[model samples]
Target: MDRIRDLASKKAAVIFTKSSCCMCYSIKQLFYELGASPAVHELDKEARGREMELALRGLGCSPTVPAVFIGGVYVGSATDIISLHVDGSLKQMLINAKAIWF
Candidate 1:
């Protein structure tokens, strides 16, 4: 949990993901398209991957692979992110976080 917090806070935008997860790939692509260079932690490629996955689950990420953090705060999973995008709020959030200037 502490590790997750540390990593999440180190970047303006952070995404916890697994390499093989399609939703993870989509979320990453969306952030890139929005011009936010998000910090992507591929849990499956980490030494402490399992531990981090469990920690993410504890933080309310049900599917967990596409957990997102913006401005050092837990934003939610891919579904939540998509909702924010659809509502035209995701871009604003990135701007506020300084992940994207425009």
Candidate 2:
């Protein structure tokens, strides 16, 4: 969990994901489209992957891949991402976090 938090607080945005998850891919693409270079952690490829995922669950993230964080805060699961996007707050959120300049 400490490692995860360190990674999160390292940048404006972070995504803990699984490499093969389409949702993870979509999330990465979304940030790319918005010109934000988020730190992406493909947990499935990490040595402590399962441990990290479990730690995330303890942090209130969904029991799934694609856990997202902005400004060093845990945002939510995939649904929350879509909701933010639909509500038109995703862009502003990124901007406020210094994840995007334009």
Scored by lDDT, the top model is: 1
- For candidate 2, the 10 contiguous residues with the lowest summed lDDT are 56-65
What is the alpha-carbon lDDT for the whole of candidate 1?
0.96
Q: Which ten residues in a row have the lowest lDDT in candidate 1?
A: 56-65
Model 2 lDDT per residue over 1-102, tens place: 898899889999999999989989998898899899999999999999999999998898885579989999998878898899889999999999999996
Candidate 1 segments whose C-alpha is farther than 4 A from its true place: none
Check candidate 1 and list the clashing pairs: none
Residue 23, model 1: Cα distance from true site in angstroms: 0.3
The lDDT values for all models are 0.96, 0.91
